[model samples]
Target: MKPKYITLIIITFGLLLGISLLGKNQVSLQGNKELPPSQRKLWSDSSHRQIYPRTIQLIPQIQATKPWKIVFVSKDGLKGHQFHHPGNCRNSSWCSIWENAKQFGDSAGVKIELAYVHQNCAGIDECISTQVRLIDDLIAQDNIDGMIVGPRDSNLLVPVIEKAISNKIPVVIIDTPLNTTKTLTQVLVSDRKLGEEIGNWVVQQLKGEGKVLIINGPKNQYNASERKKGILSGLQTGNITILDIEETDWTKPEAKAIAKKWLKQFSDIDAIITVSGNLALGVLEEIKAQKREGILITSFDNYPEVKNAIVTGDISTTADSGLNSQGSLAVKVLVEYLENNQSFPSIVYAPKLELLTAEQLIQFHGSQKSKVKNQK
Candidate 1:
């Protein structure tokens, strides 16, 4: 063959080889030709099945638009009696979340709206139904640019969240985790870790041996269940005996009633662990009313009354899981993703758990006052 013709034939053969390899590498979604073992394995893997496409195609439009509306769906509404503190708006977690979300949204130049389940729900089932209805209404409105949800039940909220995603609305789960991975991001505290810390604190206070009681939140809630598990795991390492495990609606009256019964039944209860600050306050009030003594109390959350109890030496200690920041962070994350196409991890944990005691609370406030004085 001529030298030029020989070179041309070589190039044509190389192109054919490249095309053959490319065909083998591609995996077709619709066609059912037998794939190579490696490609077939990917389809059979469970982890691969969980992968979801990013359906939020409205980022560019949201970024180009001004004053996008974002809604925060809270688990419960603001109620003064719930907190038992003078300033309900300042102390309630629901209010804190709304205020922080609104502040952040305002700063980001987005409009923030808050919707919450009615507190008078007959039961957990009713409350969850209310939440589902609220989310569906928001999604159907078709005006919201983004959504941040503090889900009441992890599994029940999955369908609505997935629906929102399919509708091209980015959803960010806050406070409690959602069961589905279709969310844009999750900003929350590690409830299990916080519970473990509380357990550890109780063990240390009791010197590795004592009888304790647990006042837990609702059985079906994710945070409540995880925290209870963590508390149990932490207590297992020590010679601790759990006197009783009681579930509450995260309410003061129910917890107080439980505590009253326990105070009457058990005289040697060494410590009490509550899933929330409000519950702790309820237990504390009952203990005081009965003139009980020497019972150490530990709790979760950053309620104002919890802090006051720490300052007054009424309770042993409590964990601050950064409840104050979860809402703000969720709003911030969603807004950043909308405006800048920023990608974040599936779970964005708030600051680490801070165990608060009387001394620590006093010192923290003193330092704050000093900083203000210095600034002046």
Candidate 2:
């Protein structure tokens, strides 16, 4: 045979062999008849199945646009968040949030709107309804990018918050932590520590031996409950006996009624601790009415009344959880997340606790100028 002819025959045979091997490896109907039964069965098994390298598709990053619109939902009504503080608009927690959000938005070229639960919250039910409606409406809007909600009740706001999360909207909770991690973040003061601070202060004042009373806020509220827990934990160290504990809605009338009943019932309340200054004032009125003097009163939220009380020896000491600072930081966190793609902490605690008393009145007076400077 010629050399070229031999090479051609060899190449043809090699091609034919390769094709036959490929057919046996596959279970295609067209080639199955060429393979043995056992070979066909093995080819159909998953071990012989087709395979490819796994791949992940990366999403393109979006540049944050200017004027990112945001909505702030406050548990309290718009008017309620406005306080008649002595020097600054910083007195109202909700108002402070609104103000700080606006300032942050202006600086960051973001737009913010404040929404309240209800102007007239006849009851807790109405408050919840109004808040739900407001938030749902805001979420439905196409222009809004995110939400900052200060929930009135931790549990009541869970559903709406989940709805926001489902819609891919980021939520930052302030003041009170809702019982959900679905939120982007929470801005809070250490409620338990604040409570413990007050409790420990009371114990020290009474020299670790006295009958103390707790005028607590709403029993179901997480912040209020945490404060109560902290107080109990702090009081655990001393010989102080908790005479009685009452849950109020942080309302003046309800606190007064509870105080009246307590005064009539217990003759030995060495000190009274209230979760809010408003409640403390209510209790103070009843005490005055009963002519009960020299009873140490400690309260939370250094409101104007509480400040005056501290100065005049009416309220021994009060805790101010840096309301304005909490509000300012909440907005700042949301802005950083939206603009810079920065991840927010699961829970962002606000600045440290501040104890307000008559001695700090001079420093408090100086705060007004700085507060005004920052607002500008």
Candidate 3:
């Protein structure tokens, strides 16, 4: 199989535009009646310079007075009990935000109540049917002032978000933010930068030549597209051949089915690159099963399975997006907005990711050595 080192390079600099896949075509806004055009990125000229939105205006801090009531809606579950977390949250860092928010609320004299959307972040249909019901209950019966939506849920819950905004309920989009217009402040990772990171990593790994396959995330998340741009842009300088790129809905089983199809179509493929943890897991299994050990497998997020795969030499590399940091930052911005009447940029790109090895994952999670190297 392709080594983890190669995967790391592709992710780190994959989206360095003008050099790889991203800059080949401009990512522009086209007027579509169904969807409104959101804020464009605020570009800055400097090496790794800060990229904040042009609309952001600095305002003075507000003294914490009344308790800030915050609600949490996550897609995760503990077994069939459901509605807890782990399933929908993928047991990702986003889940920890609940705890952090609770603690912060308590310390700052804020009241917080989290609404578990479901066992996992399944998509709009499931969220509307399940999580939306929970939100209605919270608004009608529960005692929270506002809500901190789980990442990627913003775009999925646009209509609902609009309703909340209309109700004067502050909604902050956590990780996987989409449709910043309806949100108070969208806080999450800089997918474009993450993509660039991947691109650079991939080029260095191939020494500039290979057939690479890019995997997209859930059917509608904005992060997936941006990450792709970064990956392609970063690969600009390298002689990388893209075999194909497909979306996997971020589901492992779905990814497996797609992998089987791809393996059959491109048996001689050189690498499989993805931005979803579950998708990467599925691809890794297919590669191992087919005995195509020469194929490189890489991806994003801090999912345990993906991290363990890297440790045991199954996955190439994955990055830590500080899942909890997503909620924390948005909370800071939202609290500031409510009190100071200051509005941050419509979109806020998160901090860069940290590279983690299998060993590091195990260490971070306090798992056993065997677990770190476990193979499915």
Please give each candidate's TM-score. 0.79, 0.74, 0.67
Task: Kindly indicate the candidate among 2 and 3 with the higher lDDT.
Answer: 2
- TM-score result, candidate 3: 0.67
CA lDDT, candidate 2, residue 250: 72
Candidate 1 lDDT over 127-177, as tens digits, reads: 788889989988989988899998988898899999999999999998888
What lDDT score goes with residue 245 in model 3? 80
Model 3 score (lDDT): 0.63
Error of 3 at 49 (Å): 18
Itemize residue pairs with steric clashes in candidate 2. Answer: none
Q: TM-score-based ranking, best first?
A: 1, 2, 3
Looking at candidate 3, what is the lDDT of residue 157? 62
Ranking by lDDT: 1, 2, 3
What range of 10 consecutive residues in model 2 has the weakest lDDT sum?
44-53
Each model's Cα RMSD: 10.0, 18.3, 16.3
Give a tens-digit lDDT track for model 3, residues 1-376: 4789888777777656436544332222111111112443332211122333222322222345777677766544332124334334343434555655555556555566656644554654664466666666666654556677764354556766677777888877776665648677766677787778788777887888878888887555577778888888987868988888887666677778888889999867777888867778888877778777778777786644556678788887775555554554555566666666665556665444655556565564555445557943
Question: Highest TM-score: which candidate?
Answer: 1
Q: Which ten residues in a row have the lowest lDDT in candidate 1?
A: 43-52
Better model by TM-score: candidate 1 vs candidate 2: 1
Per-residue accuracy of model 2 over 258-309 as CA lDDT, tens digit each: 8899888888889889888778888888888889987888888754556777
Computed on alpha carbons, the lDDT of every model, listed in order, comes to: 0.76, 0.72, 0.63
